[model samples]
Target: MQTIPDELTNIIASKSQKLAYQLRVAWDLNDFLATITFAVVGTSVVSGQDIVKGNAAAVTEWDKYTYENETQYVKKYEFIRETGFPLNSVIKSRASIVLDNTSKRFLPHALPFGTAVEIDDCDVATGWTQSQDGIAPTISTSRKEGTNSLNCGINTAASENTYAQYDKAPSVIDISSIADADKKIALFLYVKDKTKLATANAVEIRIGSDATTNYYRIQIVNSEILQNGWNEIKKAATKVGTPVQTAIDTIRVIFNEATVPASVTLGDLKIDYIRICDSTEEDNYIGSFIRGGRFIKLFSGYNAYSIPQFVGMTDRPKNNIKLAETIINAYDVLHYLETWQMSTGYLLEDHRGDEVIAQVLADAGFTAGQSSLETSMMTIPFTWIKKGQKALDIIRKVCEAENATFYVDEEGIMCFENRYHLSQSPHTSSQYTLDYDEEIIDVGLEPTEVINKAKITAMPREVQASQKIFEKEGASVINAGETLELWAEFQDDYGELPCTAITEPTAGGATSYFKGNTSENGTETDKTNDLSIITWETLGGTVAKMIFTNSGASKVYLTELVIFGTPAKVVKEISYETPDTDAQESIDEFGLKFYELKNDLIQSADYARTLGDTIVYSFKEPKKSLETTIKGLPHLQLEDMVTVNEGSTGETYYMYVAKIEKLAEGYFYKVLLREKVIQSYAIVG
Candidate 1:
């Protein structure tokens, strides 16, 4: 050790400094600090002298002091020496030293703390040999006054005192080859000028090669001392005062193939000291160094960033101060909250079933305060898309229709990206238009809305219960408008989707037109008591005009109808009403049902009472079934049930049940009818 001073600077615990700030307050936080000699050299190395020494290192925070990024950069100097009067005699020539992040000219990871050991600055010394452990040669020549010291800036170009010496800072000591060796090496560094930004400039003591290549480094403390006219970097480290920076670690290079390189420079240079000791003497680390880590909370789980190795820390919670602050980063607290929200959504979807789409729409921010268009394909019973204006209401119909987003093409046509699109029949003219000034369908990553011509030649469809028609006295409809509506209700070919509904009468029916006396146009009733529905009304006298209606070209096929014997009867019906259709494999708002009527010749006056709800009924049809199925209807209501098995008895009888307690006569309801009756009651359950 060098000559002992009158006072000893404490590296771990102290008595003098604490007494100086006796009145100062200490918060309720743990007083945590790393002991350099203790961690790096263990108990043996410090058995006599301090292998490394320092007071306090506090310049690692943001906004206080910063170092250059590139290991090298440029700077202009000031000329401050007297001119011409032999000023060259006293003025010194000093080499410029660049601060580089990927540099190692100083102590490998840091500078020797107590008193620094350096090699001779002459280029001719020993031809520049580096120890296998990376320590540069020791300096033997006497210190000489540097010559290139001058200041040249502004109006005054006089010779001014310089701060940092470019040729003489801390040199990095590289000993990476012994990383896994059974020896512990302690690195010492000299730091200075740790203060405010304008007053301090942090110098980096890089311990590695090019950023892309390898190693470690630290912010050289006391870099500001250079600006303050300090020449000897090693001399500054020996001062008994507050230290600016420090380091000790075992962490190796990250070696990321895809990480951005931080600024720092390095080049052909020399090394000086390498103090390697047996592993039994100490741990391969440097403690007094400010190399540290932090804890991070994550979404999938929680983890900790362990400290780097060279700084002497290898385990998590590397430091007490860091460990205490992150104690509350619990995982279940966040996981359960997220899970609860997702589960809630699932329950709502199941309870509301198909209506859940509307429920979701209700929460959408944009849908508020705006009226939606009615979709012909939708059973939405709203007034926005009333019949007789379907063409004019086409755009609005789509908006009001559920499961649709609005769209506008350049040609100025407002439309929807709905599959049930009331206007199922695509526009024959390619000149389809939309509002160009507004937002349109770019959903699902489609850059532009591609209007594809999809000719739906076939589909897996469904049919609804048969619709009954009553006779009214009026004119013979030119379009047989009432006939089209009636034929659909009495037949099976009208598919489920409104666009799939049958609008024309088939020629094969026993009586294609339910021809009867036309009724006087008087009153009407709104469609009520149903699951989902679309509404329509007759236009002129029996004309059944459906002009410009937004409910696009849709058809309705009544597969089965239920008539109550106690309700009102009907003949050939003349009123108009929107038809119910089939299952939407792709966002369809329609429904379909099927019934096996009792008669080959069904009647219109069979219904006696209007049921409260449509009974549940279903059937399966081939996916490719098209328009040809709407040919005829079964004309029966009450049929024989007793002793009726599958056979052509060729006998006709009205089927009914009555009882007299005198002597009850019982009969077998057809095995099929028995099953049907059981299902009819099952619906209410």
Candidate 2:
């Protein structure tokens, strides 16, 4: 047996179970494999895309393509997704009344009149999904009670609000269980959401498409098909249909309508499930390991055996690459996994997310399996990039146009990055190396984020209360002219108990609650600290406690503390300073003199001091030489030195990244740039 690496062995031997759980999670490479592709998506600002896999419950997340402009350098997100419920290699179906073993229904509302189920757990899926917004299902027991055929739930979109769109995803369903090689059975969907029926949407069951020309287009009605209530709509097999080329195992029931006065909805969809019933529903490929998944890999099979297995089917072992390919291959266009090392160049982990990277491939038109992950020396179409505008301008234009994230890959090819793993940050390499094109394209249209109004609380102002965050899932591409509006309603008592800023300890009534402020600095929300307390005041009751909120992305390290309040400075003590002002010396030399001077200053009679609510002290570099001999100056707190900017002119300054230590997050030490002056710099190792 091969011996484990020393670092692994040492870690295993030293840490207790508790310590092991707290330690940083060692990255497992095989668990993930992908190429930092040059190819992105089809459109600059698109509405949606597709994901196909044999048995893989694949997902896609998207990064909002944004920056100073189309040409400036942008740092995409480099993070992972939060853990969610896992649905392994199982094609669970509950199109009827959803229930637990004991027959207990999951969604009681769906029991009344909707075919409810989380059709897909893809973090990046929408349109006729299992959410309250996507493809929605409704039920009503119109007086036609006894007619057995009418006794069914209707799945339809009657209004624009149902699909959460002026017109995006009208209706869709999981046809993964029905579409097959047989041509006898056609699909039937119920409807009636629109007042007029002349303009109907093409309701068709699609199989597969080959980029263009080779796609299946099906429609419901040419003119008014169903009435106002539940009307049965049928879509028969195409007369020229030749074994519905779509991969039957992972089918997507889709609908498209244009120029229609009213929308269409589906009801009690029943298909020939028996004909396509998969024996075990566990799709095993040709090269999957007989043992656990690690014994064999898919990409290796292509490399060693020259054949590719079906994507999406396997209970992957820990850090197993062979198992990950099933999903990654299927999500090639979606973009959930960041393929770093396994490209045409070599196998690596760190991958970078950027428009420039995708442009290097898709704009040039290179397929993952067709092209070598290790190499991208394309000769055809001549090595050329299609540059459009700047990254920021692209985002603004796309946003204004109601499009998703807009990306500009290498060669100036403007498009949208796939929306595979919407929640996860953009992909990167194992080494955390950044990938960005030096050339940024800006079209000169500047964009700005409007400061949203301060939202008022709705819950009773008592106990701890927080606002509900409105998350935009799968913000994949950038639209050409879209403006996001964050509309919120204000409710006075947004809490059950007293707020943090309190004078009384009571749970209810006028004593505990107080109206919050409406300022941006959180001045009104955190104004409790401004309350006067001259004498010994009890901290137990009605006194409002100050709540400090740090929303800046970078961790802020304290350089010095500054308090603003009514208090007198009894005395001052020099933490560090230089003695002789008219001398010249190097920074190091000045450090020695500064430390010595600090010692003397502390001993001086004018150094007596006491703590107060507010005080200001200046910070300076130790310089008592011809080249730098300057008198010591008072120091400024971190707040006074920098500001977090999310606009045209604001700049973001980093403070430090520390490892868990001393009951903190991790182990670490601060390296001082100037110890005498207390300027500490972080060492990331």
Candidate 3:
């Protein structure tokens, strides 16, 4: 839970309180850009006209025409248009420019050029032709720019190129005068079904004459399309064959059936608009542009205290050009770990829980934040993290081994809390109490699953003494360009040894290769001098073999071989049954409820037993799970403790917040909670 000011607590509990939400996005690390708000009062602030910074007064003709292409940012005030939502106006006005949480950010984004010429807005279905391989073009209400978009569907039997071409009279725009060097086009499309378009070349944009001989084609890859909203594809115009610029009269959108699946149904594609402009006019627009990796902070509160509720980096942003609105979706900094893999393997021998977490975070380029992890309780004996494993997955395993929880806080910092975090500084009383009938808008309680028994299994690695596997009384010789093979079996007590290194008493002139197999007759893998120690350790076995090939001019002799490795063993298993008589009675009434866990990271028998005991104690009996809606408390976070008094059942519940969802425009929060059980732990002074 986030710490809040003392005064804000009283403000949250008030019956009638004001609510406000502020959104700020960082341009980089140090500079934050505020949301732009403007009012349309008569002709003072018109759309597509220059907005003078900090000046809302009537603009003179000189200033209006001089800076018509720029949008000025107002630093300290907001403006609202006096007229209600404008209807049927060529120029569209926006109340505010703020991206919501559901937007997808695009890569290589640019502002709409003010001098761009519209080829087609897809406002009507006429003046377009579709190939016989697919359905005809139709206008759809689902649009990104205008009132409608062009929809095209694929025939189930389409096995050839399917396309929608705008080649009819009045529909084909003349771009012959535009030189190829300065010619560029931008396309906006929304894919209804992504599964239909499976390959990178599923869509293509072609600009050429109606005869189809001269054209420039741009193939769209799978990564360029967004599954949620419109995708903007931009490319420079270049000729394909011997081209006649004056003869260019068609703009074609091809659905390459060779790349699309045969199972694609009708009506799976929608095109919003296509614009043609000079390459030099790319950045002439009237709005701000946002990209990924920017920081986003959301604040919610009343007049006096506006506390930050969510702080994270922008992941995606979706823009509506017609509405002049952009929505941004963000995730906390810890999410970066999911994209990073463990490039280097680690052999953790004697590291604490906190130390392990900190090392992993540092290697992944994150600074560790607050932690309540147990540092002195136990040290990890031996844990091997393989290369290419996800960093987040390894961290979760460490958390499971330590019995801890981890998350990113509101400050965008990674945090870890052990099982005893809450108990270490125990709360004697609830921080806040609420009357269910008055504060809660809705409430419910359901019985949770009961677990009377728990079992845990763990595998611990044990290092063994080095031993000589093979020895020969006579010299074993390999002639030049000849190869020899030797076989040896490990001791019966040590079934499979993870061989770390193989050494010969005397350095043999022949290049040596080694491998371990379960059986002597097993097919041998290709041997090389580059020994992968970790790979051999992972594939443990009993029998061992070596191959020697003579690459020198003379024969080579080898006498003995020795191997060093640690033995892999499944040595620990722990079981615990609830001791409470009530729990046993419930189990007898209902059949045995069992839970089991298997984690190789739990290296100690005592640790496994303690984990099982904790599980059984927590789930001994049926506990109540609840969901309720109450006035929004932005300070409340996941796993925070709260008390509620139920009027209907005349009961009190001390529960932990499981999930929280803001409802009705941030005025209320729908919370889910589970019964909290206080465990007894021995304390030392």
Against the hidden reference, what TM-scores do the models get? 0.15, 0.17, 0.54
Per-residue lDDT over 173-241 for candidate 3, one digit per residue giving the tens place of the 0 to 100 score: 666656777777777777655556646676777766643667766777666776534556676765687
Task: Give the residue spans of candidate 3 off by over 4 A.
Answer: 26-109, 116-295, 313-329, 369-376, 426-428, 462-552, 557-560, 565-582, 648-651, 683-685
lDDT of 3 at 421: 62
Residue 225 Cα positional deviation in candidate 1, in Å, after optimal superposition: 29
Error of 1 at 414 (Å): 17
Give candidate 2 regions above 4 Å deviation: 1-192, 195-201, 209-218, 222-235, 239-685
User: Which numbered prediction scores highest in lDDT against the true structure?
Assistant: 3
Model 3's TM-score against the true structure: 0.54
Q: Output the better candidate (1/3) by lDDT.
A: 3
TM for candidate 2 is 0.17
What stretches of model 1 exceed 4 Å from their correct place?
A: 1-620, 625-685
lDDT of model 2 at residue 38? 24
Cα-based lDDT at residue 30, candidate 3: 13
Model 2 weakest 10-residue run by lDDT: 87-96
- Order the candidates by TM-score, highest first — what do you get? 3, 2, 1
Weakest lDDT window of 10 consecutive positions for candidate 3: 83-92
Better of 1 and 3 by TM-score: 3
